[model samples]
Target chain A: MLALHAPASGGARLTAVNVAAEAVGLVIGDRLADARARESELQCHPADLAADRAALRKLALWATRYTPTTALWADGEAPDGFFLEVEGSAHLFGGEDALARDLGERLRGFGLDPKVAIADTVGAAYAVSRYSLQRLVIVPPKGMRDAISPLPLAALRLPADDCATLFRLGFKRIADLIGKPRAPLTARFGALLPLRLDQALGHAGEAIRPQLPPPAYQARLRFAEPILLQEHLIVATTALLEKLAPELERDGVALRKIGLRFFRVDGGVQSLTLGLASASRDARHITALVRLRLERLAEGLDAGFGFDTAVLDGLAVESVKTAQPGLAVQARALTEAEHRARLVDVLSQRLGAASVRHLSPRASHLPEEAATPLPALHGAPPAWLPPPRRGPRPPFLLPRAEPAEVMAGVPDHPPAQFRWRGVVHRVAAAEGPERIAAEWWKRPETPSTRDYYVVEDDAGRRFWLYRDGLYREAHPPKWFVHGLLP
Target chain B: MAPSLRPAAPPPLPLARTPTEALVNLRQTIARLEGRPVAEAAVPVLRFGCPEIDDHLPGGGIAPGSVNDIVPVGYDATPAALGFALALLAASQGPAALVQSRRLEAELGQPYGPGLQDAGIDPARLLVVSADSEADAQWAVEECLTAAALSFVVGLLGAPLSPTVGRRFSLAAQNAGHPLVLLHPHDTAGSNTADTRWLVATAPAARDRFGALGDPRWTVTLQRNRNGRTGQWILESGHGPHRFRVVETLADRPLPAPATIRRRR
Candidate 1:
């Protein structure tokens, strides 16, 4: 006999009890000491509500195979149950009865004793699944009221105090409130009783928040036998893409993000998401991209037992114009822009989109702010303004300027020499003190003004150095090497 | 002599007409053996536009569809090598990709946008790939070479590459008909399959008429040439129509004071 205990105001109370513990007269909410007295052989453990909810969520996601919409029952302290909106998907599993049986059998295989219930409404299903005597119950359409009428009033999912109040008022079954007038129930139970009944009987609409949003467009394939090899996975992916491309082509739409889901036979799921730089419906191009990603994960894609189902979902899509074939006899090769876009897509797929970037000039005088690196997938970079007629900028800029030791001839003049990175170099020539004041508007606590200089060392290697603040300041101005000019 | 046997040596086997022609023939044979295209004329050349440097290079310039290596003379001279490589890319007349590893970026810094524009390269035409490791950077360079739209690819690597990887890059560049330039640190050692290798160091800049600092200058040495004579020259930027010009050699200039004396002063 096993029981899970949780801390309560009084003491540690049993939150859950197995059949044997319950058969020995140890009920939930009983303190651990009393429960031990009732059953000396009882084993106790602390309940981990978080881990339980996570497992339930995973089960909910796995249930997506039967239907695209599944939601965890959110009214309880911890969600121990979930709902599957399988009205449209039941036919795929032969019937509602077969779907429920299959679901129950699968859950049982995972060592879970599941009580499956199906109805037209989520509330009715939730109530019947928990309160019904049979392990599996299928309420036909329009049969929700009769199926739930005999259940206790607590099955309406009201608060325990309200249930106790309703019981004191002699309302034991849902049938007791079926024919009642709305005013009296609202005055007594504060409108929850009538609302829950209306929701369960299909008079009111209740929205189910699915774990995953439905795909814009999706294609599914169920294999006759499970396959585990990477080669087979690629083939399956290609086939799924082919099936998806036509649907996208029909609507003159292209997908920018694709999600490939592999449902393993042992109820594990492996999913891969591929993002494209440009919207595309070309199955071959997309398959090549997917192949690159798969090749990268060749050793990591664990196929436990095998995957029996593969689903390709277009998570994000955009409309695109279909190009008409040219009258020329032979097709033309890819244009320069197309080649560039394809290269970005391939590189981004393998090395990730963030690593590939294009530099664009920003209109800021601050050296670091003067330019920005943007992901290459963002399309062609904007045109840069002609370079200003100032001292040349260095080809390489340090991420942050480093302090340098300087020896200057005059207080405000360029340094005669400076030491950087433990190397002391004598200056051969110098340019200027191009004063750049900090933007006070941008940063309220403005930094000191900088006196920039273009200085060349004796080796002919140019550096962009600057002196911070004025020489008269309490702290003598500091010198810093900002960039390297070639 | 035929009566003396050997059929008169088969009419001297049609010997090469000139020494240069024989050299070209030998180069083509070597290229073919290395799985490179044998047609010399079909390969495009980028001339330095100054005859002094151009004349020493085969075909009057370096081939665009080949691998080239640029190494700095010392750790401090890396900026010079980077400058020379960027000038080559700018002169290539198309978009270019620059691949650099994170370690290299940390050591030498990242490429700046306004700086590139100042050096005559449009920032929009340059794509930068910052890889996490040297291996990934090399892979990115190989991938970039496969794009026909890019005229060239540059890899700024912090570590030396294996000969096999270098050979693979060479083959990839040749097959894709794109030029590739790899910049290595001063300590990098070992042979590569590059068609040309340049060792670069900063040279004293010549002041303008007003005695101010002048255009950037580099003493570039053609350390290895598979097809032409190897030589060294002082090259300067921002002078001639080309990206670089040959600076006139000063025969009687006095050497500057030694570093120790300069520091004492």
Candidate 2:
């Protein structure tokens, strides 16, 4: 006999018990000492609620294979059940009965004994699945009222104290309150009984929040023989994309974001997401992008044993107009802009969108703030204005300025010599003191004004240096090497 | 002895209608024997617009579909090498890509936008790819070469590339008909299969009439050329985009200034 115990105010109490412990009459909430005395061979372990909750969540995510909408149901603290809204998806598995049976078989294969219930209403399904004698219950449409009428009041998902009060008032089963007047029930129970009854009878609607948002469009495939090779996965992906292509074309829509999920036989799931530079319904183009992402996975996909199911979902889609081909002798090929967009999509998939970027000019005098890096997938950048012909800027700019030691001839003169990066360079020629004041209007505190200079060292390697502030400040102005010039 | 018979001069070369056509046919035969794609006669060449430098290069310029390497002469000469590479890209008028490993970016500095504009290359037409490693950087360079819209691709690597990767890059560039320029540090020791290899160093800039700093100068040496002569020249940036002027040979001029010029306060 095995049991899990948790700390209680009085002492340690058994929170859960296995079949053998239950067979030996060891009930939950019993004192651990008493349970040990009742069954001398009983084994007890401490309960970890947090780990249980996380595992349950992972299991719920895995259940998304049956239907896109899967929610977790909790009774007291942690989730103990899953709700799959297989209303329209049941036909894919042959029927509601077949789906429930398949779910049971799969869960049992994972060493779990699951009780599944399919009903027209959430309240009725919850009551029958928990209190019914059979492990699998199917409450047909309009049969919810009769199916859950024999169960006890606790099956209504009411408070334990309320159940006791209703039992004390001679209301033992849900059938006792089926045709009773609501005014006395509301006055006696304060609206809980009437609301639960109405919900169970399919009069009041209930909504289940799914673990993940339902995809705009999705295609699924199940393999008879599990496969582990990457080539096979690619083939499967191509087939799935082909299936989705016709539908997308018919709807005149293109996918902006696609998610591919691999459901391994060992109950583990792996997912990859691809973002396109532009909306595309072309299967070949999207397949190529997916192949690039697959090749670049650092550790590769772990198909632990093998994966039996694959799902392709279009997470975000947009409507696109199809262009009619002109009656010309030759069909038109992709334009230059379209070709560039494809290249951007390929590079972004392999290296990541953030790594592939373009520079756009910003209206700022500060060198670093003069341009911003935009992701290439965002589209072509705007035309850049010609740089003002003030002084030449260095082709390479340091991420930040490094302080330098300087020896100047006059209080306001440029540096005669500066020591930077552990080397002292004698200045051969100097060109600046291009004073740029800080934007005081944009900030609460006024920053120090900079005096920039273009200096050439004796080696003919040019350096861009700047003095932090005026020489008359409390501390003498400091020098910093800001960039390297060609 | 046999009446000085030379087989009637091989039937006057029946396959040749013109000397240029005959040369092209022979070149194609040789290329097939080498298991390489036949070089097209119409491949575009990027000229330096300076007679002194252009005269030393084959076809009077560098081919757009060939791989080239630029190595800095010293640690301080990296910027000069970069400047020369950018001038080459600017000459090939179209969109370009710059690929570099993150380590290299940290060691050197990030390519500044304003500075790129100052070098006569428009910042908008350039794509920057920051790879995680040296291999990724090379891969990105090869991928960029496959794009027809890009005129050229440049990769700055801190580590030397293996010969196999270099050969692959050359083949890709040849097929795509795009130029590829690779920049290496002074300490890189591995050999590459480039059409031309240049060694660059900074030279003192000439002042204008008012005694202000003028165009930047570099002493560029053609250390290796597969099909042309190798030489060195002092070149400086010219007045317009993608233009350079040959200053003088090393023997024709003396050092402009001493190593250290300390003026009294």
Candidate 3:
């Protein structure tokens, strides 16, 4: 694939760099001018950043199905790929060694020139993947620095000029600076190199960083015997929660989100995450959520009568104030909102995270787009007052905004008549043309302008409607049926 | 000095008078759900980039002691809502939890982490959690909210979530000071009973020239809320994930404020 798509002006030709790697007549950074002069037939194509970004994004998207902590090393102009932190599930592809081979083969099959290395750090992995050319090495967590020390300076994610200068200074290997004093390195090469070195060696935090972290809570147990009962797992989790509760409490934290991890005897991590309607650091609250999830797990807490450890995290927490007694609303019955919140959370545990949502109001005049839906667990309170008095709202709002008929009206006047769900309904009582202009103040692509109206049908079914745009033949001022009023 | 930096004395434990003191808040899913109802209180509002978010939250923001989480399309996918949540929490006076994953990628950048702090969450209150598998993610969700320590918990899960799990977690969140927040992408299979499930799609940022999150049109569907009314809220175009601001029910749409808001998606 690389050779076929090398570059083409009218026809195709091999790039100078490939020819150099093949012929050994020259090397990278030897001066493109020099290489061109030596091999007049070499074809050169300027690097395409946009193409690289697109490819990287595509690859990232594909990688995401596997894990959320993938990191790309395609910064700057280097074709250097990325480092995926598959630490926990590396075995899903059949252990680390097999994972490396499978990933490399898969990339090859995808027509990507991929070299993979299972290393501990992003820098080390990048170096091994880039320079290990012949083999994909799986460096055990504790023993990675030595494996990378044998590679050249180019593997350090450093610049070519700096690499050459380091080689000239006899600092050829990553080990050369191991025990050396920092003053000389600082004085000679400035502080950046040392910082980079520390980051690579894990002494300094490289902070590759995840887009959105998983959770912060963790529960674990070191059992004397592997118990088969699922209750044991609960006990183990309780033990770990005991350890974590204090920290959370001291920090004024709560668990709205959590992750339960089970590091089995055979070197594997099994986990379950629970989301809550409210956040708290109380362990029992977390345990209840987990009990429901664990019970439904396909594996069903099997421990072969003996297991090693169980852990939990996803420390999803929220803050609550320590208000003085009688300072807030008095203790009251379970409000409808609270009941619904519990129901939503229970439903999520029974169904899935996206199954439940709350009706949130929107700024759009478009009915379907008028009020938004949010995760029940994360949604705000239900509105207590009446639905918007704007115009006529429909009785039901579909997942997607379905087509509705447009009636004649300018601004706040009720529409004369409209067709909905195939039937035409006549307007009985008319109230408005609640002008819901586009949110143009924020974006250029906003709707031209929308004029929403609330019109009650003769049958007493209040329907919310809106015009997509002001009357215009070119654009056809379309209208839509939005929401329903009780 | 770190010890000296601590407050002279934390006065007294305020929760000592409540039933919570006697109950062994075992990090259970049903712990919060099974307990007596907690009354509505004046909770500190967490301003999501969108005003609609604030509107749904008790007190016009995420009510204190609520559990919430994000579901992205996948790990590599952008957790737009998660980002917005973090920014809101970071700008808050309390701490926030950042759950970690073991499969795909792992790096917590200051540039991104502080985006929440920049908005208003207390950076000092941030917590980081890493779970090895899906089950662990669920357990962590319950654990964080069951405890009265953390202010918020954020998670990135492999699946959408089930109804049972959602209820238990919500219960845990109520009693403790913490709230659970997760990021479940679109691909997270199955159903869930989340208090508010937001279906966030991408839209161009409003003013960010060099790739910043502007006011993206999020198709926020209130899958579950009181009154059985599901709808969407159009957030104004702005600049980053947190830049999208919710527009009011223009002209004359005013919903009766919820008395006790326990969830805010």
Give, for candidate 1 chain B, the lowest lDDT window spanning 10 residues. B5-14
- Residue B160, candidate 1: Cα error in Å is 2.3
The native-contact fraction of candidate 2 is 0.68
**Which lDDT tens digits does candidate 1 get at residues B143-169?**
899888788798998889998898889
lDDT of 3 at A215: 47
TM-score of each: 0.90, 0.89, 0.38
Instruction: Tell me the number of clashing residue pairs for each predicted model.
Output: 0, 0, 248
lDDT (10s digit) by residue, model 3, range A369-440: 544445557755334223344433332333344467756755434578888778888875555566766666
**Candidate 3 — which residues are off by over 4 angstroms?**
A1-217, A223-235, A246-253, A264-270, A294-308, A314-344, A351-370, A379-390, A398-401, A404-419, A424-479, A484-486, B1-265
TM-score of 2: 0.89
Tell me how far the alpha carbon of residue B252 in candidate 3 is from the true structure, in angstroms, after superposition.
43
Candidate 2 CAPRI-style tier: medium
Q: What is the lDDT of residue A463 in candidate 1?
A: 90
- Rank the models by DockQ, top first: 1, 2, 3
Compose the digit string of candidate 2's lDDT tens values, residues A1-486: 899999997999998999999997989899999999889999999999788878888888888889999888765312477789999899999999999999989899999988889999878888888889998999988999889989999888777788899899999999987998899889977877788788888889778888889998999999999999888999999999998999999899998899999998878889999988788887888989988898999778999989999999999898988888789979568877777888889889889999999988888887778888899998786678888877778877888888999998656798999999899999888898788888787778868898899988777788899998887767888899988887
- Cα displacement (angstroms), candidate 1, residue A200, comes to 1.2
lDDT for each candidate structure? 0.84, 0.84, 0.55
Supply DockQ values for each candidate.
Answer: 0.62, 0.58, 0.02
